[model samples]
Target: MPSLHAIIPAGGAGTRLWPVSRAGHPKFLLDLTGSGRSLLQQTYDRLVPLVGTAGVNVITGARHRDAVVAQLPDLPGDQVVAEPAPRDSMPAIGLMAALIRRRDPDALVASFAADHLIRGEDRFQDAVRQAADVAREGFVTTIGLRPTSPSTAYGYIEAGDALTAAPDAATVLRFVEKPEVDLAREYLRAGTFRWNAGMFVSRADVMLDHLRREQPRLHAGIEEIAAAWGDSDRDAVLERTWPTLTKIAIDHALAEPVAAAGGVAMVRADFGWSDIGDFAAVSGAVHAGETDLGIVGDPRDVAAIDSSGIVVTSGRAVSLLGVDDIVVVDTPDALLVTTRARAQQVKELVDHWRDAGREDLL
Candidate 1:
């Protein structure tokens, strides 16, 4: 019956849904799920019932402090933890684990991304509660969603006999990187495979133990950062040393080693969820006032016509003809027009634009 801590990593700058999701506005801030709440807000809201106000923590970038604060006003401002810069998830997770350790070393921390949409909160919460119960018993756990497609975008977790029944637990059999289409399909057919939900739960001490066993070097650095954690002049300490921490990902630094150590376990999730990685997915869920936004082509646009899959948005003057599967975002300063399938590659396009010195468009 120890207290539970929830760590939500909101530092990712989702570049795929560009123009709409730029440097200052990542995809997580968008009302993509049309849930009336943003993805980050949804993430924050989802935990309120489970953890209470005192148990949740949101870890985001210093750049996004205002956005997060404004989005989740219900949560206390002190609950929000901001990173000095983008150092990837590992450092962010490591830092939070250390800070939380100072407060309660044996506390069970449930960590997840801030930008995912889930259709079943009850199931998700059920799975999290189950995981927390296991964490209380000293297990490092992650919730893995059942995959409906062979998505190359996600890293897959192969949980052999893990959690086959009620309150079940087993060791991780393999950690598979994003694979080729053929192999992904093969994994889908294999009952043991599960999509990495980017969700994890464990005691801070367990994670520190993981760092010591699998990634000692990163662990030592993280411990140093923890020892240095204080608010006497937190800004000064964070600014001076935050950049020194390595930028490796948590999966690379910790999950891989945990899997290697045969202690990693996953719970099969029954929630309906999506990453909402692009505008196409975002547009599918927006509600543009009801009557003011006319349905021009595609029905999902909140207003689209014969354009079955075309996402078009604008005032009364906007129109589309003979177009399908194109994402047309109409903002005053910038417009994003691209095929929905290629949306994932837009980050590379952003790099290209930056490399070409087109900061205006960026």
Candidate 2:
């Protein structure tokens, strides 16, 4: 197998997980799993075995650059690429691919989001290895997680024929957006669909070629920035060219088009994974007692009396009584009180705060 480099795109405000996941400290920087390590640190831990410490790179916003570096001190300074502004995953991952190709054209690059959680490390590694192997065959490969439920929250990937070079891999037919509940159930029954976890692997050159063909202007800008990556002009070039590039996601810019052209592959991943997009997922992953009550912060600070819900405390002690299926997140500046079913709408609260001119709470 060729050498692999991992790119972790550590953007996204995680508005659904507000209060605890703020602009200054996003979901990726929080220890939502209660495992003593933040989500980004866990992601780094999972990738280090496959790509080594120096082989892993992180692309984040300029504001979060210091936090990302502080969390991953072992990562090289040059490996932490900070974007002056958010341009979505396409520009972030594309820049990383260009930089990796600058070092070694044949290097295999894999992009993983910074806030996802995966169980069964061995299975995750196996899936990534298979994806990398398929990538070496000059195909853009993604890890298609086996859907455990008809989840309307996640996008689906339709698998087509099996690859001759990689029997464990399947040609991607198309990428589907998050469907309605009824359609999601139908997809679950079909068994040919897998949840698109946004994990992608490809040769750096192959990825760049697809970008050049599909998004010429974006590709050109990244190429120019990559050329001056190690030089003194890096900052100046990135500042001037980045904002001029189109703001789009990698899935729209490369993955969807590449899949339609029969150039994308999928590796079936049977391991457990969660993007941890909201408090509901956090509740499922972390629990305080035998009940469904999930406590993210110190459990000792919480007192539950027949309450079965999620409770996150900052410093003060919280008492929950006779409340079922509720979510209470307490921080020094803000406190969130809602239910798991309404977790997806937490972003509205962030918007409301913004409109209310309470930027400090956000």
Please name the candidate that would achieve the greatest TM-score relative to the true structure.
2
- Where in model 2 is the C-alpha error above 4 Å? none
Q: Write down the worst ten-residue block by lDDT for model 1.
A: 288-297
TM-score of model 1 vs. true structure: 0.90
Evaluated at residue 7, the lDDT of candidate 1 is 90
Per-model TM-score on C-alpha atoms: 0.90, 0.98
Q: Rate the local accuracy (lDDT) of all candidates.
A: 0.75, 0.92
**Which lDDT tens digits does candidate 1 get at residues 1-362?**
67788898897777887766777788778765435688898888888888987888888988898889899887888788888888888878877888888888668888888998777789989989888876666667878888888878778998867453337455577678888999999999987788887888888898888878766766776777677666565667677777887788878877877777776777777687777776555544454344223232344445345554434443424555656666666655766667767767778878888999988767
Off by over 4 Å in 1: 163-168, 283-303, 310-317
Model 2 lDDT tens row, 187-250: 9999999999999999999999999999999999999999988889889999999999899998
